[model samples]
Target chain A: MTENRRYRLTAIAVTLPTLMSATAFEAGASEPGLPQLDIATWPSQLFWLVVLFGVGYLVMAKMVTPRIGAVLEKRRQTLDGDLEKARTASSDAAKTRAEYESDLEKARNNAAEFAKQAAMEATKKAEAADAKVARKLADKVASAEAALAKAKTEALANLNDVAAEAAIDAVAALAGIKTTSSQASKTASSIATKLAKQGAN
Target chain B: MSNSEGMHSPVAQFEIKPLVELSLGGYDVSFTNSSLFMLLAIGVSSIFLISAMRRADMVPGRMQGMAEMIYEFVAEMVRSNVGSEGRPYFPFIFTLFVFLLFGNMLGLIPYSYTFTSQIIVTFAMAAFVFVGVTIIALYKHGLHFFSFFVPAGAPKVLIPFLIVIEVISYFVRPVSLSVRLFANMLAGHTMLKVFAGLAVMISGAGGLAMAGSLLPFVALIGLTGLEVLVAALQAYVFTILTCMYLNDALHLH
Candidate 1:
C-alpha cells in the first residue's frame, strides 16, 4: 500500500514538473530565460519550504533520531556490560588460581617440615637407646667385679676356721688323746701367735 | 542552441509551474512543482528515516544502518563544526542536510523538478539561515554582534576600509550562500539536460550521427555520476556552512 502511494507520488512528481517547466520555460524563452526570477512564486516556495522543512525537522528530531540514538545507546550499554562481566570472570579465575597455588606451596612446605621433625625425633630416640645400653654394660661389669671380690674375702675368712679345725684334728691324732676343743683352739692360737713373733724377730 | 521542443531548453528544468492553486488572504500561495518536490523531499526523507528505524534494533539491518550512519554523521558534524553549543540546533541542521540531500538527489531523476536549482527556494532557505543566525548573534551578544563586521587586528588607518569590506561581505552571506547552491544545482542539471538533448538531437540524425550520440550519452553518464557526488557534497556544504554560521552566532568571531 505504501509502495503504491509512493509510486503515485513519484508519478505525479515526475509528470507535473514536466508540464510545469513545459509552459513556464516556453514563456521564459520570450522574457528572462530563468523562471526562478519570477518573483511571484517566491512566497509559496518560501512558505512551503518552511512548512515542509519544519515538518521534516519535527519528524527527525522528535521521531527518527531519538530511536536511532536509543538503539545505539542500548547496544553500547550491552557491550560494556558484557565486557565488564568478562573482566570480572577473568580476575576471579586468576585469584582462584593464585589461591590454589599458594595452598599447594604451603602444603608442600608443611610436609617437608614434618618429615624433618620426624627424622630428628627418630635420631634422638636412637641416640638415647645407645647411651642407655652402654651405661647398662658398664654397671653390669662393675657389679660382677665387686661380687667376685666379696666372694674372695668371704672364702679367706672361712680359711682360718678350717685351719683351726685341722689343727685340733692333728693334735688329737698325734697325741692319741682327746683334748678339749677349747684347749685345741687355744693351742692353735698360741702356735699362730708364736709363728707371728718368730716372723717379726 | 537547440531551441526546439521536447526537453531542449536546459532552463526548462528550472521552471516552476503551479499544481494546486491556493489563495490565502488574497495572496497567490499556489502550490507549484517547487512545492511538490519539497513535499516529496519531506515525504521521502520522513519515510526513509522513519521506516528505517521502525524496529530500532540493537543490530541494525541495511536501511537501519544507513539511518543510524546519517544520524551519526550529522551529530558528528554538529559536534565538530558547531561544538556542544550547537547541540540545540542539531535538529535544524540535520533537517536542512536531509532536506537538501533528498532534494538534490531526487532531482537527479529524469523529468523531476530541481527545486534546489531555484534561486527563490535556495535564497529563501539561505535568507532564513542568515536572518536566524543574525537574530541569534544579536540575542546572544546583544549590540556586540555588530562588532563581527570589524576586523580585530587591522591598523587604525585601514579600520574604516576593512569595516566596509567586512560589512559588505557580512551582508552578502545570504546571496553567496544561496547563489553557490543555486548555481551548482542549476549548472549541473542544465549541463546534464543540455548533453542529453544533444544526444537526442544527434541520434535523430540517424546513420553516422546516431552512433556519434554515444559520446554525449557517455558524457551524460559520467555527468550523472558526478552530479550524484555533487548532490551529496552540496548538501554537506550547505549544512556545514550552516553549522559554521550558527557557531559564529553562538560564539563571536
Candidate 2:
C-alpha cells in the first residue's frame, strides 16, 4: 500500500508540471525556445544555484562532515583504549608468571638445602656412635690380658710342689739312703725358686 | 520549440515554460522548469543526507552507508588529487560533487528536466570553481601565484611562447570543465530522445512498421542504461578535474 501511494505521489510530481505547461501553451504564450539556451532564465538559474549551493556547503561544513568526523574519531579512540587495556593485562600476566616461577625456584632451593643439612647431621651422629663402640672393645681386650697373666703364675706354683714330691721319691730309690721328705722338699723348692728366678730374669 | 501538439518532437523536450512568472526591477527573473528541477536536485540531496545521517550509527544502515560512501568517495578524491593541504576545501568539493551527481542522475528520470544539460548552469559552477581557486592561490602566494602561467624549465627563446600557451590553457580550464559535463549530458539525452522518437514514429505507422519499431525500442533501452553510466562518469570527471585544478592553484606547478 505504501508502494502504491509512493508511485502515485511520484506520478503526480512528474505529471503536474507537464499538465501546467500544456495549459500555458494553450494560453497563447510565446515559444520559450530551448530552456537551456534561454537567456532570460539564466539569472534565475544562477540565483537559485548560488542560494542552494550556499545552503549545501554550510550544512555539510557545519553539521554533516563534523558529525561523521566525530563518530569516526570516537570509534578510533574506543579501539585504541581497548587495545591498550589488552596490552596492560597481558603484561600483568607476564609479570605474575615471572614472580611465580621465581618463587618456585626459591622453594626448590630451600628444600635442597634442608635435605643437605639433614644428611650432614645424620653422618655426624653415626660417627659419634662408632667411636663409642670402638672404645668399649679396647677396654675389654686390656682386662682379658691381665686375667691370663695371673692364671699362668698359679699354674707354675703347683708344678713346683709336684716336682718336690717326685724328687724325694727318686733320691730314696737311687741313693739307697732314706732322706727326709722335708729336706727333699726344701731342696726341690730351692731349685725351683732358682729356676723360676732365672726364668723371670 | 513550443510544439507540444503530438508530444513526439525530440526538441520540444528542451522547452522552458515559466511556472511562476516573476519580474524584479525590469528583469524577467521568471521561475521555469529549470529552476524547479534545480530546486528538486537540492532538495533531494538535502533530504538524502539528512535522512541518511539521522541515526548516524557506528555501523551504518543502507541509507547511511550510501551517504558515507559518497562522503568518503569525494573525500578520497580530494585527498589523492589535492593532498593534505586541500583539507580546508573538502566541504566545497564535496558539495559540488553531490550537487553535480544528483543533477546529472535526476535528469535521467523520465519527464524530469536535467539542469546539468544546460551550459549556463555548468559554466556558472565551473566559473565559481575557477574564480575561487584563483583567489585561494592569490591569497596564499601573492605575486608568485602569477608565476603559475610561466612554465618551468623552458629555454630562453621558448619562454614567451610557453607562457602564452600556459596562460591560455589556464584560462580555458573553466570552459573545458563546463563543456565536458554539459556536452556529455546534452548529447546522451538527445540521443536517447531521438531513438525514442524513432520508436514512436515507427510504431504509429502500424502493422509491419510496428514490428520494426522493436529495434529502436531495444536500442532506446540500451541507450538509457548507457546514459545512466555517462551521467555518473561525467559527475566524477567534473569533480576530479576540480580537485586537480585546486591542486594546481595551491601547489602552482
Candidate 3:
C-alpha cells in the first residue's frame, strides 16, 4: 500500500508543473468580460466585415451570379425547346396515325366490296352452268322420246303383218273360209292404231 | 480543451483573442478570432460557390446541384416576396443569405468562433438592410412614401395615432431583426457550454460520482442537435425577413 501511494505521488509530481504551465497558457483573453460587449473591438469587426462583405458582394454580382444565371437560362431554354420538339413530334405522329387509320378503313371496305363482287360473280357462273345443264338435259329427254316413238311405230308395222298371216292361216284351216292377206293386214293395222291411241290417252 | 482559466466561465469561448493586430486611421482594427471566422465564412462560401459552379453542367453534378439548389432557393425567395421589380437586388440578397448561412453553420464547429453571435455584426447587417430598404422606398416613391405610415381604412381621428404606431413598428425592424439572430446564437452556444462544463465537472469528481455525468452528456448531445437546427432556422429567418422588408419598400402598402 505504501509503495502504491508513493508511485501515485511520483506520477503527480511529474505532471503537476507541466499542467500548471498549460493552465497558464490557456487563460481567457486579456479583457475579462464578454468580447462582444467590448465596444473597442467593434471598429475592427465592422471594418473587416465591410471589407469582406463588399468583396464577396462584388465577386458574386460581377462574376458568380451572371454565370449561374446563364447556365439556368440555357438549361430552361433547352428544356423548353426539347418539350416543343416533343409536342410537334407527337402531333405529327397523331396525324400519321389518323391517316393510317383512314387508309386501313378504306382498305377494309374495298376488301369487303371485292369479296362481294367475287361472290356474286361465282354465283352467276354457277347459275349459268346450271342453266346450260338444264337445257342439255331437256334436249336429251326430247331426243330420247322421239326415238321411243319411232321404235313404237316400227314395232306396230311388224305386229300387223304377223297378225294378218296368223289370221289367214286360222281361217283356212278351221272354217274352210280363206280370207285374203291384204284385207287381214288392213284390219290388223287399224286395230294396232286404235290400241296405240288408247295407250297414249 | 481549455484549462483552469476558462473553466470558471462558460462565456470564455466568446472572448475575442487577437491573432494579429492591425490599425487604420487611428482606430484599432485588430484581426481577432471573430474576424478570422468572418473571413472564413466569406472565403469558404465564395470558394464553395465558385468551385461548385466551375463545371456548371446542364445536368449538374452533386456539388453543382447543391449550389444551384441554394441559388434557386434564394432566387425564389426574392421573386416570391418582392416580385419582378426586385430583380436588381437579387445579387445582394443572395450574398446576404449565403453569408449568414455559412456564418451560422461554420460556428457550430468546435473551437471556431460564431461571428453571427455578435450583436454588432448582426446589427450592422440589419441596419444596412433597413437603410437600404428605406432608400429604395424613398427613391421609388419620393415624398409620397410617407403615405405608407397612415392606415388607409381607419378614421381620420385615428390617423395620427396609427401613423405613430406604424412608424414605431417600421423602426423596430432592425432591432428585432438583429436581436432575434443574436439572442438565438448567444443562448444556444451558452447553454451548450454550460452543459458541457457540467458534464466535465461531474466527471472530474472521479469514482462512482462520474456516472452521474452521463445525464449532462446526453443533454449536451440533445442541445447540440437543437443548436444545429437553430443555426439553419435563424439563417432562413434573417434572409426571409429581409425579403419581406424589400417587398414593403417596393410596394408601400
- The numbered model that scores best in DockQ is 1
Q: Provide the lowest-lDDT 10-residue window in model 3 chain A.
A: A16-25
lDDT ranking, best first: 3, 1, 2
Docking class of 1: acceptable
Local distance difference test, candidate 1: 0.83
- In the order shown, the candidates' DockQ scores are 0.34, 0.25, 0.24
Which pairs of residues have clashing backbones in candidate 1?
none
Count of clashes in candidate 2? 0
lDDT of model 2 at residue B106?
A: 91
* Candidates' chain A TM-scores: 0.57, 0.63, 0.60
What's the TM-score of each model vs. the native?
0.81, 0.81, 0.73
Task: Write the residue-wise lDDT of candidate 2 on A115-157 in tens digits.
Answer: 9999999999999999998888878887887777777777776
True contacts kept of each: 0.67, 0.46, 0.58
Deviation of model 1 at B251, angstroms: 1.8
CAPRI tier of model 3:
acceptable
Pairs of residues clashing in candidate 3: none
Q: lDDT for every model?
A: 0.83, 0.80, 0.85
Candidate order, DockQ descending? 1, 2, 3
Model 1's i-RMS, to one decimal, reads 5.0
Off by over 4 Å in 2: A1-34, A135-201, B2-7
- For model 2 chain A, where is the 10-residue window of minimal lDDT? A16-25
Residue-level lDDT tens digits of model 1 in A145-190: 9999999778754554567788768877888777676676667667
